[model samples]
Target chain A: MADATDSSDPVDALLATVDDGDVAFDGLRLEPVADGDDGRFALETPTLDRSTFGRSELRDVLETVEEYVTNWYYWQGDVGGEGTARRAFLRWCERAPVVGEAVTAPSAETTLEANRTARETANGTAPETTAEADQSLQVPQRQDALRDGIDREWGQLCITARFVDVDEPDGVRVYDLWHVDDADSDVADLEVYDDPRTAREIATTDEDGRYRPLKTAPTLPSGWAFTGLSGDELVETVGSVYPATIANWHRERLGELDVDHWLETAERQTGIYDVVDELPRDAVEWMADACCVDSQCLRRREWEYEEGDELDVDGGDGPFPCREPCSLVVAAARKWAILESETERTYELELTTSEFNQLGELIDAVAEGRTDEIREADLGDGANRYRARYLRAKRFDDDGLEARKRPEEY
Target chain B: MQALVVAAHGSHLNPDASDPTYAHADAIRETGAFDEVREAFWKEEPHFREVIRTLESEEVFVVPLFISEGYFTEQVIPRELRLEGWDPEQWDSDGTSATEVTLSVGDANKTVHYCGPVGTHDAMTDVIVGRAERVTEDPDVGEGFGLAVVGHGTERNENSAKAIEYHTDRIRERDRFDEVQALFMDEEPEVDDVTDFFESEDVVVVPLFVADGYHTQEDIPEDMGLTDDFRLGWDVPAAVDGHRIWYAGAVGTEDLMADVVLERAADAGAELGDAIEIVRAGAGGSVTEPADVDGTAGTTKTGD
Candidate 1:
């Protein structure tokens, strides 16, 4: 429960302002007794029973508010907490039109009056601020702002926390965490989970049932949510879906992220991976460009060649920072080192200019993971499925490409 | 006193690589020996760099569930844990030495007693023997079958082969098997030559590696002619090259590995007082036997 002992805060201010008449805003209604029987008042919501409390029992009212709003995605810790990924996400939820227009938008009259007042004030003239703007904008009820719910998109997940009419207060607040694809689907239409571990299982595969080696790859499947999770449970589910994302994001905000650069990480390799250190510095850049791109991974790489020697390529633009090169990178570097050790050899092959361009287009399409988007019917597209098949049929023989043998075979 | 951490090299592709580690931790947790038992991974959640900070315990015992003492145990875990006295230059220094290391975490000091890996423990010899006997489904199967211990050997680190060789020698000295020969995956006398190396008509190959991942599940089985197609599991006692062979899964995945981890941690805990005493004596401080040293034996221990 939120402590409401302080009289100067917004909760007490709202409580003090409610006179003998009732004040109604959002889904809550507060009324004061005309008889003033022990200074008691009734606080009522559609989902919960009307409860009468004395003026001194403000903490009980605050507790009810806390329980009600927190269930509706009003994460108290992140609301006024450090500017972490969670805080950034909340800001996006309130400002960006995730599902539709922003819910906190003021009335049309209020907006028009504010725009006119802003134009006059900026012109350095006597302020023509409407009398209604001062009362509605400046002196708006703080309680109405506190009761606001959230609806936002995080990765592929559509999160909705809002008040819903139900028989009990526990059921008043409903939180729905589902796939963004299923935003229009009813709750009964989607598969629901309650345990955090279920998120880990869901993350193991993609839509085509292929194993997702990279958890943060932009291929998370749809149609499921760990619905009705508490704030702690929701965080745990997110952690299981994308491990260490919150921790790394928080560490970066605190400026305490320990980044192990490519050279430092490669030098620490032992066993068969010790050969990774022997990779030429130029080859390191190529590996990062190939593997650390946003198309392949979803982490913002913080590591570089070393301190003050950033890579020429762009790191990913993910919301969370990758403090070090993951094990997948290290393992891949080992194989790359072996491949890089081979001597350069040249073999002659005949191909037309268009054929060479088509080959490049094919490679680019595969590398950027856009092959699936190139439909087989799109024959005009060089990297289309059927077009690639035709290229393979023309260039490939049983022996090798273009009937050309390798230098070693010759 | 508060927690036991079993650290292992997990794989990003194979979720089952950490299954055995989690199962062992759960088994130990059910025993109620410690307040918490956690499994940290090199390639999974609760990563080595962050698992320590998540611990509420002041005293922690970290036991590596690796097959042998090598790169990961010696360099990676210590550096990731940020041990107070870890020196990067000392490549030959054994990080598995039963010693108390202080982790300086923001002014307060936390004690982490690093224990030797469970794979190199003497009790692991029993795990190998158990794997052999279970695969054969006979208590006295060692009398007729030659046991082959396979390891992921590398020229980069001679210690990887040494651990397998030590276990092979230990098993041979007991005279429980008809024949025991150490085989390597990357060195000579490879696991592929298992059927031809021994005179016995029947052989039982037990992989002395951690996790039943790629190596134990596919590579070794495929190379030994136990399975023609690439798959995860192999039904053993299949005839190959005129020899009937029983291929067991990786020894680290065996249920007895939980006991091995507990043994490693308990041994380090039992030696903690002696380690302190030796440091005290080296500093010319008078050492006296503590009066409250309990003789109760098992996994749980009290730290003063």
Candidate 2:
């Protein structure tokens, strides 16, 4: 720790502000000692027991806090930056809120309740208040209460914040990032990554070791965590796992995201992808419904059919904006366009009601990529591998489904 | 004047998709021709749509390190970079390649010159011949060996096949190989018919692709009957039916690609001034002479 009087270092500059009385910030409390020459200070946090410290020891404690707060400001920018998604997320981590309505409104309610208790006491009768009302009066106490750990799900990532020392909030505060699927596993069990580039390697494959052509696909592999990351390191590691997501999320909050819709994007295609423009308008809506849903991609689709012409489908509920149709969507649209060109045909096949519903379940399982999740032992599920095999064995022939010939043959 | 941006298509599943672009950029950066050499990818970090915002450079040279001039080179890259006079309507109507496009970026109106892809350059024929010749140890120097340039051709884009045919014709004009044919992975006269395409005892197959991903690593070798079970970095020079087959790695990942990228930039009118001279001019406010940058050479292995 540098000299506490030094005005240049950020931590020192902040500590120098503690003068006569106690000061509180982000759950840490500091009080200046009466000893003038020693420049001692008393410190306390929700978890850390109250203790007296000389200048150097106090400086060491404040250094770690200053680093965490400084990095938070650097990556998160001003606390009041626009967009409520990240702001709500930060508040969930026990950090102070940008808008203090949630904090200040409760204090006002307690103040009103406190005045009622004063009036009851002045009536010369034993003052009585319900425990529920008394709980509201302890607003400041709630704010000072110790929190063991906090976790929130952002897209596929499970972000966690925990105190590093035994019951010492002033000690190092560490953050961990991992796949939400691995939330139940021990940190020691998961593969650990310190560098941001390792996140890229982990994001390259799925649970069954298949290449994930789309990073936003709902098939992220589990069993990995990036622990003990600083604020900027956490942000950088998350960005590597899902590139441009943080930037786009921030841009959406700032109201500066530029969205290129489907028609304009398709019109610009010059080669084989040019056929994507030939898709019927209704088919385009189907395409968005198929590929842009939250079950398929993590990004919320911001682009519409044109500019203000919205598709009749629900765009995902992701915090980040898609901005435009991705390459995967374009590639899928091209195939759909050619398939749409062929004349439609209806074939007659005999099936029971249960078998008919099974076909729908089979399509849903494959479309949502949940076929792998259904186990062969779970034969009750229509999409179970052995169940589907039995259905295929019963209905499908070498010629076609239910031994039906091609429509052209008729 | 400020930086060289090598833009290419990247993969989320396969890191090998962008390895060649990164290697080429690193090789070019070593020459000290520009103050910075950065890479932008369609599917990776620093995406093409926002790569310019990451740069403080006022003037940049954008080279598309792709294999062909098609959807990406003519349309996707130009639009993403927001070129000044790029009219996609015009490209779609005429089906003509945009050899060079210049876009003004940021408040400073930074000059961004978008150069054509390196794959279609005439210099690629030399790289292809070098790849074919290097695969064999025969003292005959690939004189009697038939050469097959394999490409991932799709029915959706004619340009993919045209790129392969262009190199095959150029290589045939030299009269070096006994036979030259354009084989595709998805089109007619596929790579599976390599043995039937040539009657020569020895045949050299070169994949005219940008990177050694699934296509080059597994699919092509499996199609050629070279290996029944293929993995990454499969062995070459296997014998089948008394015919010697020499399979080369993807042509685009060659180390000499640095020079090919520079040639494409030079064709787009880039002034390759030495970075040391530029720095001296910034400090002293004047320069007596500007050194000419030597082109990069030599073949080195790609990817870690």
Candidate 3:
């Protein structure tokens, strides 16, 4: 960990220590947001507002880190580019206590000890000491166990290289190892390495890197190669060997990416946002009456529509804190419209102007509850069908009027 | 005698909420027990109100296929069907009362027998126990596992919890499992606190809901930390927390429920003349109607 008392500029002070042979260090700081008046932590940044990110975003980042760290060797081999940066940051978070405590990295000895203890407990046998257990454990078994242990603990910390845009023969690329608990603080400082090979050599070298050293370096599996690869490329290349690791890495990335552009388009097309834009007063009032999808928006009554006012369809981008085109509203409207369109419906008869006028009269008669008077009118062909249509139209008109008249009824 | 309508609280968002009701209705219809066996839902078509208009039968028996005797069974069914003898004002002021009423509908004084919900029937305790027992790896060594009867309890009404407690007590009396407890989704002794209730490593949680809807399919499994990868109506045990959690489908969807519905219908004084034929054909010897056996009238098979 870099000494805090070095200088005022934490980034430059830390960066100054990086040499050609030493581990590479990136100046990026990941820290926890501080508490605010609203009893929530607000991210203090220039590019993003205090309200732009929340605990959810922090959780996503942590989840990403957790995945990469838990399966480090796989990520080291298979994933490349930005993935390497994320893995590196996570490793740094693990090694650097200022960032976060690393997840428990189980060792071969510990795993063997645990298995023996479990066996003893289940069999009701007397517990054996470490020395006794070690004496009975075979050499090949121990080696296999140790290999499994390190493999399990792979990516237990952020282990990746960072390339800084500097005028250097090796391109100023540095390997980093650090860990930061997402909940504790947002600020994370990395431990840097000069090159990928140097970083791996140090990592495997007992008492030097984040991991505990094995008695002997485990033999590499068939087809394993680390030559000619950058620190990031090495991690990705290693990660690619394990199918699950790469698959999970891809799965996590897919979740992070917003692929629901159709959902947004659907919301924009049919949402109350467009309705509000068209008839600001009536639509907003209708929404208020219809009840805004957000249960927390208590200012629904006070929401008055101005001509130039725009409802925040995204719930955060607008000037006003109106949750007008909420997810529920969009979903409900889309579903209702879809159901209406999908249902088998037809208008069989194309009436003449005279027939249309008569139909209107019939609808009015039904709306006015003049059924007794309409019963005495002259009967025409398809009279029953016309009457049914008239009743349906009247009911539709009544429903529309009712919706407008008393929005509270909904 | 004319028509049998299974009334349920359906969901507009989840169509599967009303699926079991429709399925049960179809099964019962195949028996030809009544003129028509139809499903009436509050959310879907044919709607509860619109259902009556379509029913050509003068006499109707509406058996609420809900798990407990709560708001939906007592209030919603009565209100929607416009059944006589239930005061709308009294229902609105006090909600559903404990007293079950048999109402008459239409000017012809057509009898509309409002039977007790299928869940509240005395035979249902056995159904719940059976659900839990099916998932038990060793049925003979019942002491190794715990049985949890989960219900959709409501804070608004104590009756919801009471029904669950009633079934739990009966299951406990049988003394088949090491422990039998009642848990709720919306009340104390919640589904989340299930581990605290059971010391046994293996626990079987049987949801006493009416359908394999959102609550059963998503919420309960999520709360219990069980993977809900299976489709709706899949009755299988999921492993969680080093224990096997046998999540049974809602009690209302069980094949044996056809018997319970007929029992409810019989209790309401409906002449179930061809019920034996329906049970024999539809349930395949699963349902034993009271009227089928001599001196077995009003006597249901109970858990020991």
Candidate 4:
């Protein structure tokens, strides 16, 4: 088994990690590609395998995975920057327990911080400028708090507290705190106090009025707590509310796969085929000389099939080229069979051949607006019953045929 | 071939509310254009669910016989028909855009085209004009006569008034009458104030409704002082308040509406061929070209 970190190229390094054995997670299997791009990969399941699909098919499958992952977690700016495939993979590893442990990838926060540092270093910035960079990052936090103040003054707000090594501002670590205040106005403007009671006093005190102590301490909102969660716990908390964002972050980390090719192969194997000489032949060619129904499907001159292989066909004697019946052929055959069977049966009619022709002419005359007379054929009981059924059938086809007849009153 | 279902907001107390709707269904049925012509209502017998149960065709077209694109047309009809892309529970008061939806019902797949209410069609304006003309002694000599279009306006939704206002504007554009005023039974300018807006001695009042239900037969006539009896059939020009008020039946009950109904069905993809002839034959009279009343000659607008 090849190790991921051994290769210089990140994609190659990741591909080398997939062993010969199947790696399954959430019903998706990451299988090694035998012949593909240098680091090509395939994802499969019981019913679907990327290796059997064509180029466009595989591409759609891969794109679906990509889109799903992107929508899930990467949508949140908290994850790695867009288009950073390596960082995206690392994020996936951190989220997907099986895949994450298999690759031994670093945490999402660590990778995020590392990428940021690398980006800053590439921009020709010195290590000493880290302190200035930290200050700029705090701007968003301040803006969020200010906006929250304008919207409402109630509820517990989350605030971050930073404790820096006094001698080294660059060696700072941050901690989060849930700030609960009962004040109805300017909650953002109040200074941080020891607890909710003190915070409320400073927030509620009028500009010209003296500070007064409350008789009863205010109760915090149900879930309010002094200590805040961080790292994985923080990611999990955010993921719970925005599952799509989390799913994207995890999927993108699974690395890229050749999805279009796999999809095409899968489609070719599933559609209608002609069973002849105990082999599956192109059903389209045998039935109709037309391309596959799928507009984007690849036109194949020959389809490979093995003898005695149980093809997925309706009412087929054995494993043959034609696996299943196309809807067009089945419908045509069914109609033809019905017509053939109906021709064999005879109906006793009371009307002569000449009278039947007159009836047809009269019906046409009414439809063409030549006459308004509604004349009924005076056939006997059995024939009249059959005529009524025939009229009912015609009514189903042309709702207005009978209406063209003038009533007896007219 | 598709099944055409005429969906109506049926009445519980007044059975006559769905009369025009049923008449329209019979007219369409005679046309022979659709495989099946059925009537479905929100509140009456042969309910929507029951009507859907009898649908054997794979494609269906639901034409709402509403006077306007109001709450019933926008929400109720679509829900009852199971038209694609609509969820009655998900609907909000903000209103939804009128778009046709294709949905599947049971083993058969159906593309349901929920058309606009018949009253909103431009052709209906011609029916209203025809109804007004029929009741008046001489419709051509209309230089001094007033036309009052009565509608069942509601305080619950503003769409009812909007529809009436639209017809009033269309009628005014014709320049046939001296004055055309849109009055509502519920909202302002109330139907009771019909005489206030007109100075003409002879006023032709046409009900812009689908049927001669409670509102059109009872409420509108009583408000306009056309009849104090509160009966189902009021004699035209019931001399009242020193003005000769010529009361007409609901615009939807006009024979010309059979053409509009077929036009609506055709808009929903029902082929119009022998069906047109069928409607003409059933009408028992010369079928007026829909182009004559649709305002836009040769152009028929369906589903609004």
Model 2: per-residue Cα lDDT over B1-304, one tens digit each: 4778899888654656776776677667666886657678776656787666444457788888887777788777777777767755533322224366666753234788877777777777877776765566442455778999998888888888888898899989988888999999999999987898898888888888777666776677778887776632344576766778788768876666677787777667776655323322332110100010010111112221
Q: What ranges in model 2 sit over 4 Å off?
A: A1-8, A11-153, A159-176, A181-186, A228-236, A375-379, A403-410, B1-5, B10-61, B68-71, B87-101, B105-111, B120-205, B213-235, B239-245, B255-304
Q: State the TM-score for model 3.
A: 0.39
lDDT of 2: 0.66
Q: lDDT winner among the candidates?
A: 2
lDDT of 4 at B101: 42
Each prediction's whole-model lDDT (CA): 0.64, 0.66, 0.46, 0.46
Q: Write the per-residue lDDT of candidate 1 for residues A1-410, one digit (tens) a residue.
A: 12211233445435654653564433345678656558777776544567878888954675657443332223222232222344323333333211111222366543443343323312333223222111222112322322354565555666665444432323233455777788878878778889766887788789988767667777889888767665445655676677666656645534456788999989977667789988888888999998888877788889998899999989977767777777778888888999999887676687888877888998888888788888769987779988878877887888658644367564
Candidate 1 chain B has its poorest 10 consecutive residues by lDDT at B284-293
- Order of the predicted models by lDDT, top scorer first: 2, 1, 4, 3
Q: Which ranges of candidate 4 are over 4 A from the true structure? A: A1-410, B87-101, B105-108, B137-141, B232-234, B277-304
Arranged by TM-score with the best first, the candidates are 1, 2, 3, 4
Chain A vs. true chain A, TM-score per candidate? 0.63, 0.64, 0.18, 0.18
Tens digit of per-residue lDDT, candidate 3, span B138-208? 43636777888898888877778777888788878988888999999998899977777888887878788
Compose the digit string of candidate 2's lDDT tens values, residues A290-399: 88998888989999999889998988877567888887787788899999998766677888899999989999899877887897699889998887888888898886
Per-prediction DockQ, in order?
A: 0.24, 0.20, 0.01, 0.01
Model 3 residue runs over 4 Å out of place are A1-410, B87-100, B106-109, B136-143, B228-236, B274-304
Worst ten-residue run, lDDT, model 3 chain B? B295-304
Write down the TM-score of every candidate.
0.66, 0.63, 0.39, 0.38
Location of the lowest summed lDDT over 10 successive residues in candidate 2 chain A: A130-139
Best by TM-score: 1
**Model 4 TM-score on chain A:** 0.18
